[model samples]
Target: MTCQELYIPKSLANLKYLVELNLSYNELEGEIPADGVFSNITIQYLVGNKELCGARSLALICTCLCIIIFIYWRCTKPTSLIPGTPSMKEYCAISYYELVRATQNFSESNLLGTGGFSSVFKGELSNGTFVAVKVLNLNSEEALKTFDSECMVLGMMWHRNLVKVISACSNLDFKAIVLQFMPNGNLERWIHSSTTPYLNLVQRLKVVLDVVLGLEYLHHHHHQVVLHCDIKPSNVLLDEEMNAHLSDLGII
Candidate 1:
């Protein structure tokens, strides 16, 4: 049996007297838990999981940031969920395992869209909060750059006309940015899909105005003049109220 993306859960380390664990020839990601049976497992047992690492000599040395993020998740479990909350760093520090579970292991049914280097999936958190998880393909350097840029920029800015980034998740095999899911979808669908009476002139103007306002904030109100290299119908999302909000700032 081959698993595309396997996360060695923390609970597996609890197994006692389970010797001779052989996990070779399987695709695995994230840190190898350095407790319980895993501590004694040899490199031969974990071969081919290039993304797996920890205190084990066979694995790569985990960065301080990754370790810190893991520790935070291990210690803290939020009791409630609220919109516009200020737990940016904490909320963003999520595990690939959590995202997989949230999105039903990235089932095709939850897939929203796919770009040049990533696929967006609809996810629901344990607290019933919805999010759009943009999972990037790490094999592409451009995708990595986009992920980094989006995270840095989104962390620093906020505007009603602009899409909101709620949190982020990163691991050896998985990297994603969690965003506020737009219920109405993007402007492209309304414009191209065979929907009822096309957007009236007033609605069209409102969408244009929303895009202009979002761009204005990024270019003028922000500390720096941010440029969105790509602005198209698909990138302009609409909320439940049909209010347009500019999204996909990865290339900005």
Candidate 2:
């Protein structure tokens, strides 16, 4: 259901026991408040499209005792952030079954790119959410180690500068990671694409700054120390807004 204002309807009151309210793909606008009698509601998804003004929940040591901060944090800014993280939990993640459907059983057409360690594919899952899936061979001990290390490290962190893990999927035969989709593809592709506008020196500099900032964040800031051992131009991706996203750090 979609709600877009100060005075939400009383009809919604009937859904008092609803667990997952997905109002993500909507044009909901205005401030999000904790007022009203339905204040008990949780897991309210107002993402995808909206001009939401406020939220309430977490605290600081960054704490406002007068108000609770919104834990449903979404990044709306265009400025690229950098976090040099050695772990993978800092991002979102998707389930294994979800990946199977998204990639049509890992078909070749969905293949976006590939590397020695894994192959990347374009995917739109059962929930109609677009994403990028990276698959590693199930038999390789090295790949297993990389995936486990990433999950342990990345599962615990979250930031705009870091590439979000949608979820992880595994089977006796293989394993994979689901990540937020990047329509613009990666920086390496754009840097050489004949159909795209070339990034000049200033643009390159800015991108480099973005990458550096991300690395710095990973190294510092986060709850635990992170080190992005794997760093290069290809590991950097750009989204629709030209924001940078780092991917495929095999660091343990």
Candidate 3:
């Protein structure tokens, strides 16, 4: 189930007989009440609510109170105080510090590839799930525009042959998009690697079909038109079973 503006009712805290509560993968907003049902909730039970915040153990950043004080101190305009965070409507908002630790300071060993405006690094979360982290270069204005574009497109589209967006992190100096790791690497590696066997005619057809289906979904399935301006072997990723998935949508 999907909801546009779902707020966990405060009356839920009054249910003393309720022993367990599980509300995940829904568009929930507002502060999570800390009275009863929320008093002992953990990350597993509360994850996927991208806009939730409270005194919960989950690292839901509660910066509203702090931002209010800062605005008062500066005597600035009072507009809607939206955090400079990744659009949490689709994916979890991760911290830059967590990403740094996950990639081990983005060591060379974990470096996947460098693109025009960003670099991809392989990272493993605390739960041991691997992810591809695209770190954007904040110094470039063009790069920031590209990052915002990618977030807008990827946040709305989902398909079997498209790379899964796990989470994202964005602050003043840091910005990164977290994605599910493709184990078999990109199509370029498989075709160029000397040790790897050549892809047979059947396997080659499958890869092409995957790409076509992914592009079809982007153009026909979405409400708005999306153009994937960049498409190449290096941008086409493969899974452990050699299934193809498109990646690198910054220019899409």
Candidate 4:
């Protein structure tokens, strides 16, 4: 086949005593069979098929297979062996693979927002619990510190006006904090979105009051005084009932 568009039949490898196969100048785009007739063919017989690859293609396939296996192993492996702190004991431990599955491997569509040191994604756990996963950028030393700060602060505190911590996944390579998922999203969206219904004066007042309560608990009610260095409309999230809850205490 000269200048024709076709794939070399893999069955050709099964032919006994078959030799001198010439598949030059054809649109053969895939791994060449490494058996039988193919094993005997030289570069001359398969010349001009730029898309055709041999050992390189096999190596690529092998690499892809390895990646798939690695992903599968991560997903199936249990996180029970990982040690947890006293605060972590209060909630169920989550594995890195579960977070991967929950967020569809951190697909762009599942992303809720991006910040300086991390990105937030909406996900659902295997137990059907909806959660917001704040994955920290491991590359940044500040992000690592943020992860530690949030874990230390959120794990010990609980207030209705504050977003609750579900669990956390921390490893040398990856760190993520799981928090209660707010369906209504942040206060910034409500204030900025032209498509959605605008908040009335009463609703606005209630939202402000909710934020004040959350801040009050953090500043005074807790056993230790915690300062929320960053407080903005975007940092305030709303639950299903439109009740506001302050979040993102990474800099606490």
Candidate 5:
């Protein structure tokens, strides 16, 4: 057993950044605390340790997920599912566990940036695909409303220039939206970072064009007549080819 079965306090349940439980070869036994600390440290690595025998945690989780999925599947009349095809729905409703894993327990080192509503962090999934997670700690009713409003608006736009929303997770009062990673980071940094070359007028003009084109599409082709309510240099992102994208479209 290579993990620590510490007395995971229930008070720490809201903290999403705690990772790594090296309980290794401990003589601790008898029904591990199932919530808070114990719940997160579910992976008990047992080698030649006999004191590790206990009720299986994986079974409980599987059962819970199955139940939840069943209920959600039943209640939510999925307006998705194309005719005569697989139901591998796009824009999956990301789970808390997935979000945690992606953000490396939401570590600050993985943090890509921050803004008025939340902070953005760079993360990679089990599949190695990099993603950026925007986490907003809604401390008040007003913040929650704003979060909901932004989420609702961003959830609809799928334009090339507009920022893309991969998925979202709301768990334990923590709200987060996962987006595809912009390898070059924000356009503001790319154009201004001392480590990078400064953008000439031509490059800047191209970026503006891309940003406006995205907004135009949102205004016209998008499902909703969306507005790029918040537009600034900091909100633009550049791709590998220097193709500009308008990022972070929150609500008014």
Candidate 6:
């Protein structure tokens, strides 16, 4: 029979001998009890209940529950602090599954750029926060070393002219760093693209000043002197207001 109820009745699970159920083409909108008939019924029997989840439905309630729990842990759990670094409470812990969802399985359309050892993709987190995901290519030893260097350096540093490290995901098979999203892209594009608006003398000077300040902080202000061996227009990212920030500290 057609069940137009908002939820599948939990009492239905108590029917021990009930062998068949056809709750198809209903307005049901909640979890389906897994006991009794639900366990035996095919997905066809529950067709058209778009909001229905759990048991034989296409979306399972258990999966949603797990995501909720995962998000809670990521937000509430205390991260290990680096020796000379500020509190890492601002960084949210992320998972490979979340990153996959954010970037649509790292689709080519989301690719921001690619480097010799890694590729960057634009992603939007569940909370609607935009971020850049830099996925490392683990086929070579140097790539692995670069990942380590970036994590070690960025984790301890914070500056307005430096790209902020949001978090990182690391496992045996996969490694990625999540960073602040730069909307205006890199200086190389703005300087080289004929179609892009030309940078005036003042704007050009501001970008140069930003890069110099960032370098000064890294080389002199930090507790330990750090040097960025590679500096180029491509590594200078522009944010929404055309503010410049230095990025790609992997080779430092």
TM-score per prediction, in order, is 0.63, 0.60, 0.63, 0.64, 0.60, 0.65
Per-residue lDDT of 129 in model 4: 88
Error of 1 at 124 (Å): 0.6
* Clashing residue pairs found in predicted model 1: none
Per-residue C-alpha lDDT of model 1 across residues 50-139, encoded as one tens digit per residue:
777656734433333454575455335332223453435645566788789999999999999999899999999888989899999899
Quote the lDDT for 209 in model 5: 64
Residue 164 lDDT (model 1): 82
Write down the RMSD of all candidates, one decimal each: 24.2, 17.3, 20.9, 22.5, 22.5, 20.6
lDDT tens digits, residue span 27-120, model 3: 6877788888778764557768788866663343433344456545433332222243234484666788888889999988999999888899
The TM-score obtained by model 3 is: 0.63
Clashes of 1: 0
Judged by whole-model lDDT over C-alpha atoms, candidate 3 comes out at 0.77
47: Cα error in model 6, Å = 75
Better candidate by lDDT, 2 or 6? 6
The collision pairs in model 6 are: none
| Residue range 1-252, candidate 4, lDDT tens digits | 454446677898999878768887765777788888887565556767778777735554565576568556643443212233236568889999999999999999999999988899999889898899999898888887667767877788777788888899998899999999999999999999997788975577678767777777777667788888779989999999999988876544
Per-residue lDDT for 3 in model 1?
60
What lDDT score is found at residue 76 in candidate 1?
A: 51
Task: Summarize candidate 2's per-residue lDDT along 34-145 as a digit string, tens digits.
Answer: 5443354332354443454444222111232222232111222333434464345344455676677879978999999988778999999777889888888766777777
In terms of TM-score, how similar is model 4 to the real structure?
A: 0.64
